[model samples]
Target: KRRLEDGEDVLISGFGKFCVKEKKVRKGRNPSTGEVMMLDKRRVVTFKCSGKLKKKINGK
Candidate 1:
């Protein structure tokens, strides 16, 4: 959490990596009412599994 807050990527050996990403604000529409709206920008955390971990999980 702290690493993510600091915009740093964290990696766990034999596991995966966590990184922070910035999302830009954009226009959106409501599905039900068809009303146009502006989506707020925000930071998001993403994770990608290590190749070794993926192989292990797949029983390879």
Candidate 2:
């Protein structure tokens, strides 16, 4: 959690990896009113599973 908060990539060997991604500010529309708005820049965490884990989960 601390590494993720620090925007670092984390790897768990056979499990997978965790990464922090930065999203630039962009224009977006409100679904309800169709109004244009500026989206704020933010950091997001993403997870990618290892092939070994995927195979195990799929029973391959």
Minimal lDDT window, size 10, model 1: 1-10
The global Cα lDDT (0 to 1) of model 2 is 0.97
> What's the TM for model 2?
0.88
Question: What C-alpha lDDT do the candidate models reach, one value each?
Answer: 0.95, 0.97
Best by TM-score: 2
| Per-model TM values vs. the true structure | 0.86, 0.88
- Cα deviation at 10, candidate 1, in Å, is 0.9
Q: Write one digit per residue (lDDT tens) for candidate 1, span 1-60.
A: 798899999999989999899999999999999999999999999999999999999999
Please list the residue runs of candidate 2 whose C-alpha ends up more than 4 Å from where it truly belongs after superposition: none
lDDT of 1 at 38: 100
RMSD to the true structure for each prediction, in A, is 1.2, 1.0
Task: Put down candidate 2 lDDT per residue, 2-54, tens digits, no spaces.
Answer: 98998899999999999999999999999999999999999998899999999
